[model samples]
Target: MAKVDAPAVEERQKGILGWIEKTGNKLPDPVIIFAYLIGILIVVSVITDWMGVSVEHPVRVNEDGSPVVEPARMLFRSELIEHLLVRMPTIFTSFHPLGYVLVVMLGAGVAERAGLFGTAMRAAVRNAPRFLLTPAVALVAMLANLAADAAYVVLIPLAGVIYAAAGRHPIAGITAAFAGVSGGFSANLFPGQLDALLFGITEAAVGSLVTDWVMNIAGNWYFIAVMTIFYLPVIWFVTDGIIEKRLGKWTGGAVAGSSDADDDPDAPLTAGQKKGLAHAGLAVLAVVFLWLFLTVDLVELVSFGAVSVWGGNPPLLNPDPALEVTQQLIPFFTSLVAGFLILFLAAGVAYGMAAGTIKTHRDTVEMMAGGMKDMGYYLVLAFAAAYFVEMFNLSNLGIISAVNGANAIQQSGLPLPIVLGLIVLFAGVLNLFVGSASAKWAFMAPILVPMLMLLGISPEMATAAYRVGDSATNIITPLMVYFPLVLVFARRWVPDFGIGSLTAAMLPYSIWLLITGIIMTIAWVYLGLPLGPGAEVGYTLPGAN
Candidate 1:
């Protein structure tokens, strides 16, 4: 029997992407990189301060509601030390994703540890019709963002298993799943922690200029929902049509001995697993009904004074007191991450009990604790990230960069489409350096959000563009937190599969996803689409309003 030909060495070094992985892998860890950056920011801040570099506030207002144009001062040693010594604790605690990740993980951790997520994913793909397998895996991968990190851990490897069982290339399944998981990170069917994290940064940036402007958590909801629709076919087609064809067929090797009784496609679902799945379905429905009960104001119930939680507030767009609350999404939006927490927790508890992975309430607590334990490294990363963002803000470098960047774009006299594309491209470039979405947004929003707003772009629109660039390059970048884990997943199937091989496999997906992202961005902006509920394509200065 002939051995399957390994991917060529020349292919690994074929172009810019290969060079990127090689150079990128040689860099220090993301935490160390951020620490070094913090040092550089201090020195640069002092020099820029000495040079007296400053920019007049574009729309900052004074106490009496007049437009305040005070210059933004650069950071100096005294202020830096004060921030480090006094506010360091606040800086780390206030990092937006810290609480979000922890809270959500408490539930997700239980779901994962109880074997609920693993069984659910296995059942999802194991039962998928042969004709629909590609899209099924891709769709599940996209939706798995709700589980955050678990998708990468559970789904990607499972995809490889599913494909190998079906006699398709296992790497193709891995590619498809990774594309959806990371490449399409920003695209989701609904708003969750990401919305809360990104828009909180937007709110902060907007507050820097328009103090009264309200930041809706669902500002990017409509766009992201639509993005999911647009991105699905791209991954489906790229993986099934393009990637699979290039790789020929799977003449199996390391993947041969990788069968499991738990995930075996031939084994029929037991009565208990079936019952657990039914209970899981009911749990999801219960969550849906509960949220609906909280979000909607039914006249029948309200007439009897059994008030809904959101009944007191008016519509987001129109605030006339006499008008009834037509649509209130803030309470719903704010609760989305928590809603996921509840949904997962309830479902996991139900499934765990029925399937015997969790027998008691103590088991559930242990599961949640296990989830928190898994977040140890993330907690450390968060501390470093929070300081980097807060310090950068204190240095005034973010605002200075934004002002100069906005001025440069304004002077370019280019079309808005070209300008927006450039912003996306710039963000893609930045993704190569800083891998954390929240940290990068925290640093960039002070500049990009306000800068684009001054350019007549909405803060939501700026955020949408930033997300496209941020997510598009995630698969190919070695610095992404999960990149090495993904490589390990691949090597299990092909022991000789090095970093270059994994990157080489994923490079096509990255390129096509980015191009599709750029097109989606240009179309959405040029077509003047609303980003989400109450989110517009343009902004008005509060003073002007």
Candidate 2:
């Protein structure tokens, strides 16, 4: 790849892209925006509280069988001040994505600094055809979510490097991967952590109405698998045809923190780098084997004095019959973040040693430190975002708004298919304010699942619809936990890339995805397709058929 001045790449903004970019960039910095949102939330909470605004809690009911009402609470009280002042540290620390990014970067930093990532990218993509790059990244990004939030940190930036190596726009690469990882979040080939979480909530929500309803984590399996198939081309087209054209070209030099010595894509790997890659390869295999070993039943050992039995299904593969299948894999699913940290850390160390990048322990420490240093901006942004999210939850506005929306849909008396489509739209709209998929579902499932069931729409169908809406809007929402992290990634390539820029770039993916997802969902229902194993798109309540 040829390195040129960053400014050599022309900005060709036009049409909707130009308008969105112009309008979005007009906003203040992300931190200030969050602060403003916090103020607005407080005012909304006070007004809603004053007006006695409340909604009937869908799942929780009184002993007399009346729905429990949840009233909005004022956030301007003395208690609010104390919570903010006293719990400031905890609030920042407890932000879930904070630990995820920091831990993963600790390992990823060493990998990049030691030239492991750059070398690997060159070695992997050198012989590959350039045309297939976007689809490959899109596929991997969707599947990579099995590692949970680690994918956001690990894959998105790597996509940029991979694109740069192929002589394509790095920001375009980031856009495609971001869209797949987030906007196509629900569209994985197999069930993973999200399946377990959302389905667990679905099971509970339907339990009151249907006593024997067992949660099938794979309820949306076929639907999501099809989603994967459909989303691949959408991401590919948008990245190759739309985003790349808008991005113009990649005349920029190597990304910061990368080894310029090894930046050329066509350059042959040195003997030392080759040896290092082999070592890193071995390290990755070992990590994979270790994780796999922990997922199966081991030999039973006789207890003798100081010895205990090793025989049993490991925690990673729970043998407990009482839990659902996905529930059983919870331990393993949750362990993926740690698995990735260890994986990257081990590979980087092995590569660094074999490739002559790390001569001393201090070198490795410095690499990790460098990685953390890069995260400085993200840490500040996360602080403001964490407080805003927590305060929104405490104010009861998010849940109340979701419940009221569901109530409105139920009362619309629209056709069942149209109502289902509305559920998708509602979920997508609600996602802007409540970014957590499980959080929004917990509030929604209670109302949607049972309500839809009464209308002869299966809980699986309702869950599937929610998945569509939840995923489609993720890339467009700054409130999404990883949105700032992605913005940080984009700025590494294009310093001018702002919150508005990202939102505008991702707006196309969001719109098309929601449209396609809604269409697929409604069509599946109309055709009476099976959602998954023993999961149908339509339901017949007991004694009604």
Candidate 3:
């Protein structure tokens, strides 16, 4: 009887895992997650509305203008319009934002397609000392995200080759890069498209609870940068200690795709690409210098619907005269553009020097066009994601759930640090199954951000907490879209290493990072340092009380 029950239990476990895998993928997807999560919110909202949760909205009477703040009963299913699903289709479709992201992705795709980015990674690896390989790879991978997809297709694979050549496991190389790039998704010295979109979502959420709420892109910058510092050392230790130790030793020959330290006879980097690197680097440095000079001098980049270099708080950060809070976070807001510009400038110059095609001014323009062509699929994904979010918003379901859930959390006796830790852990566990950062954020942000706001935690603080959880367990989760890719890279050294094998190797890192992160959050709360500009370490009203 015992033996028979054991087999049955095993089968049940397997069944559970299968179900989990299916749900995980659907949950982190923009199209699916937004739909499901938002649907839940709407359903919950209706229930709560039925139970008598109401807010008396204040608005001034106007003859011609629609009142700004109208009474909003938490929407109920019955409250939904008859054309609801019909109306939802257009809203969902509208969510796919293709333009702004593409403007940046096109340039990114060009550099990546031109082999400039490939050359850059190889070049960095070849030049870097062995001891520094872990740190360098981690740092570069985190920074390379500024170029969008460049890190995924380019840096990840290249990492395996570089490590294999350096007498280490190729899989370990991929893991390190993957860890830094995807796991460190929220950690960037410079923000990118993701930042802009998230801030927009946050701004909208804030407005729902406050009048003229401003959520600048840079609202979470300082926290992100600090988190980067928090993450780097942890990653370095994991790569150097566990991964490399497991691989044993590197054989003499280079791996398949490596640029070959001795110079590849097939497709070599040209002097032009080298020159491009020099130029790109210079351009990036110049931009950095200019920014520092301006910021330190208190020059305003955006201010009160105007651009002014010399002024007060609202300089370049706050472009809306009506939204003053944005000014406090301008650097975070504009960094995405800065990130794109830097990647293009660097890759463009590098490509120009290596390919020699960029020697003249015309070649550069063509390179820009070339970049656009490579961005074809990414544009599609972006559009789909946009539609997903927009659809969820129009439903107003996510808002309802967030309000109720946040209200529940606010009423609970949980400590503030406890809340942060739990969110991080939730993100970590969910991350293992789902593996889509933005999708998770989209589903979570509507509820988590507002909920935390009710707890007197700033959205920036909530964003930071979400980031920590989402990134820490990335390596161990088989569900991460990039997880299998890392495994394939790992298999180069340990031929039999499969999903279980990879997870075992990476589990220690994931666990330790989580522990450390929890510790850090507690320390941060105790210190009472601001998470960002005016972002409190404790609870406060979502808006003016």
Top-scoring candidate (TM-score): 1
Give TM per candidate.
0.88, 0.64, 0.76
User: Which residue window of length 10 is worst by lDDT in model 2?
Assistant: 1-10
Q: Write the residue-wise lDDT of candidate 2 on 326-393 in tens digits.
A: 66776675566567678878999999999999989999999999889987976887687667766766
Write one digit per residue (lDDT tens) for candidate 3, span 508-529: 6677778777777767776777
Which residue pairs collide in model 2, if any? none
What's the distance in Å from true for residue 369, model 1? 1.8
Rate residue 38 of model 1 by lDDT: 80
Q: Write the residue-wise lDDT of candidate 1 on 1-545 in tens digits.
A: 12434445564654777667667768776678778878888788778878887776677657896655444345556766786789778878876667766777788888888877767777777788877888888888877776777789888987887787788888888888999989889988877657766776676676555666655667888888888888888888888888899878887832445555663565777888888888888998999888776655455356765654455632222334564442345445656668778988999999889988888899999999999998897788778877776776676777677778878887888878777887888888878767888767866787777778777899989999999999988988878988878776676676677667777777788888788888988888888988887687877765555
Which is the better candidate, 2 or 3, if ranked by lDDT? 2
Candidate 3: regions farther than 4 A off: 1-30, 33-100, 250-253, 256-270, 286-354, 357-400, 532-545
lDDT of each: 0.77, 0.76, 0.63
- Tell me how candidate 2 scores on lDDT: 0.76
Question: Model 1 TM-score?
Answer: 0.88
* Candidate 3, lDDT over the whole model: 0.63
